[model samples]
Each structure stands twice: as structure tokens, then as C-alpha cells.
Target: MVIDDSSAMRLILGRIMRSLGFDVVEAPNGAEAIARLQSGAMPEIALVDWNMPVMDGLAFVNAVRREEKWRQITLMMVTTESEQSQIVRALAAGAHEYVIKPFTPDAIADKLALLGVLAY
Candidate 1:
């Protein structure tokens, strides 16, 4: 799932995910993304944006980690959250991977590879 409030960002990330062989589900906010998950959307991996309306990514990460049924889903932070402290906080919140904004597909691919989520 691609969680971002910006339509352009969502479009870009959706394209990237599809290029990487994923059929993505999109949400404009963390709450909506969670709603989708509850509504039977089983995305193996979620590429989440940090800043959003309704609910932010950090809150979403904490929420996702709290759910036992969704534990199998890999959570990756894909956003402009470049601050070191913020990154640590996000990682400590159970995010599986992190990718900064303006990152190339290779960067995302590399992190996904490390997490064993990228298609072979």
C-alpha cells in the first residue's frame, strides 16, 4: 500500500511499486490505509509516507505493530523524514526499512532487497 496525502507523490510511488512488480493499494492517510487493511487488503509490503493528514506515518507504524494479524506485513518508510532523531524514532516504532525522499528506484530496491521483499 502507498500511504501519502499528496496525489503526485502517490502517483510516483505507485508507478515505482508497479515497476518493481507490485500491485499496490493506495491511501491518502494512515487512517485510511489502516481501514483498507481491515477491509481485506493484504499487501505484503507497505510503502508509507511520513507526513499526512488524518494520521501520520509514525502513528501508523505503531498502530500496525500493535496488530498481531498484520505482523506478516513489512513496513517501509518512504518519505522526506531525514532527521536522524526522527529516523531513529520511526525505526524504534517497528518500521522494517527507510527510504528518504527524492530517492531513486535503486535506493528503494536496495532497501527492499535487504528486507527480502523485492521480487527476485
Candidate 2:
């Protein structure tokens, strides 16, 4: 799953995910992503963005972490917000990995590999 308010970002990330053998699903905001989850879209990993309308990434992470059924989903934050404190907060909120904006596809792949989100 790729959750970002920017359609271009979503397209880029979705393409990368598909190239890496994932069936990508996208939502423009955290609320819609959560709604997708509630509707039985059990993605193994979710690439989320920080700044968005209708609910941000941190809140999404919190909401997912609160639910027992969603615990298996790996949450990765992909956003422009690059602060040490922000990273710490996302991790504390149950995000498994963090990637800043303007990243390469390789950077995303590397992080996914590091997190074991990519299946061999």
C-alpha cells in the first residue's frame, strides 16, 4: 500500500513497489487507507507519508498499532519531514522504517530489504 496525498508521489512509489513484486494499493490520505484495511485489504507492507489531509501518517501508525489484526503489517514512513525527533516519534508510534523524500528507488528497496518486508 502507498499512502500519500500527492498523486505523483503515489504513482512513483506504486511503480517501485510493483517492480519489486508487490501488488500496490494507494490512498490519498490515512483515513482512506484505514478504510481499505477495514475492508480486508491486508497488505504485507504499507508505505505511508507524513503530511496529508484527513489524517496523517503518525495517526495512521497509531491506529494500526492499536488494532491486533493489523499488527503484522509493516509500516514505513516516506515523507519530506526529516528531523531526528520526527523519526524517533514515528518509530515510537510503531513505524518499522522511515525514508525521507527525494529518495532513490534503490533507497526504498534497501530499506524494504533491511526490514524483511520484501519476500524472497
Candidate 3:
């Protein structure tokens, strides 16, 4: 799933995931993502955005990490939060990878590959 407050961001990410042969799902915020999970949507990976309304990415990461059922979902932060401390915090909060905004599709693909969510 691509979880971002901006529909445009979700669209762009979804397109990239689709091109990589993924079936994409979208949520506008962390809360909605959780709701979808509760409704039984088990996405293999989630490309989450920080600095969202309702609930942010860190909180979502923590929430997902706390749940055993969600343990298999890879969490990747695809956001503009590029500070080293922020990256550390997101990783500590259970994000498997991080990608700053203004990134090329190749950058995203590279990270997803590193995370083992994509082949090649």
C-alpha cells in the first residue's frame, strides 16, 4: 500500500509499484491505513509518508510493529524528512527503509530492491 496524504504522491508511487508488477493499495493517512489493515488488507509493503494529518508515519510504523499480524509488512518511509536524526528515529520506530522526497523512480526502485520487496 502507498500511504500518503497527498493523492498525487500516492498516484506516482502507485504507478511505480505497478510498473514493478505490484498490486497497489492506497490510504490517505496513517489512521486510514490502520483502518484498512483492520478490515483485512494485508499488503506486502507500505510506502508511507511522514508529516501527515491524523497520524504520522512514525506512529504508523510503531503501531504496525506492535502488531504481530502486521509483522510481515515491510515499512518504507518515502518522505521529505531527510535529517539523519529523523532517519534514525524512523528506523527505530520500525521502518525498514527510507527515501527522501524529490527522488527519482530509480531511487525508489533501488530502495525497494534493497528491502527485498522487489527483484532486480
Candidate 4:
């Protein structure tokens, strides 16, 4: 799943995911992502963006981590939040990986490979 407030970002991420052989789903914000989850949509991984109108990525990470049923889902922050503290906080909140914005598709692919979500 690609969760971002910007439809353009979601589209770009969706294309990247598709190139990596993933079937993508999209949510405009964390709230919608949660709603989808509640509706039984379970994607293996979610590429989440920070700084959203509804619920931010950190909150989403915390919410997902608090749920046992969603334990196996991998969360990756694909955002512009590049502060070291923000990265630590996201990781601490159960985000498996973090990628800053303005990233190349190779960077995203590398991170997914590192997380074992994609084969090299």
C-alpha cells in the first residue's frame, strides 16, 4: 500500500511498486489506511508519508504496531522527514525502514530488498 496525502506521490510510488512487481493499493491518509485495514485490506507492506492532514505517519506506525493482527505487515516511511530524531522515532514505532523524499527508485528498491520485501 502507498499512503500519502498527495495523489501524485501515491501515483509515483505506485508505479515504483508495480515496477518492483508489487500490486499496489493507495490511501490518502493514515485514517483512510486504517479504515482500509479495518475493512480487511491487508497489503504486505505500506509505504507511508509523513506530514498528512488526517493522521501522520508516526501515528500510523504506532497504531499499526499496537495491533497484533497487523504484526507481520511491514511499514516503511517514504517521506521528507530526514531528521535523525524522526528516523529514530519512526523505527522505534515499528517502522521497518525509512526513506527520505527526493529518492531514486533504486534507493527505494534497495531498502525493500534490505527488508526482504523484494528480491534483488
lDDT of 2 by residue, 1-120 (tens): 999999999999999999999999999999999999999999999999999999999999999999999999999999999999999999999999999999999999999999998744
What number of backbone clashes does candidate 2 have, counting pairs of residues 3 or more apart or in separate chains? 0
Listed in order, each prediction's TM-score against the native is 0.96, 0.97, 0.98, 0.98
Position 71, candidate 3: lDDT: 99
> lDDT tens digits, residues 28-112, model 3?
9999999999999999999999999999999999999999999999999999999999999999999999999999999999998
Q: Give the range of the ten consecutive residues with the poorest summed lDDT in model 2.
A: 111-120
Q: Relative to the true structure, how large is the alpha-carbon lDDT of every model?
A: 0.92, 0.96, 0.95, 0.95
Query: Which 10-residue span in candidate 3 carries the lowest summed lDDT?
Result: 111-120
Cα shift from native, residue 34, model 2 (Å): 0.5
Residue-level lDDT tens digits of model 1 in 1-120: 999999998998899889989898899999999999999888899989999999999999999999999999999999998999999999999999899999987888889889998754
Native RMSD of candidate 3 (Å): 0.6
Candidate 1's C-alpha lDDT? 0.92
Cα error, candidate 3, residue 113 (Å): 0.9
| Cα lDDT of model 4 by residue, 8-68, tens digit | 9999999999999999999999999999999999999999999998899999999999999
Clashes of each: 0, 0, 0, 0
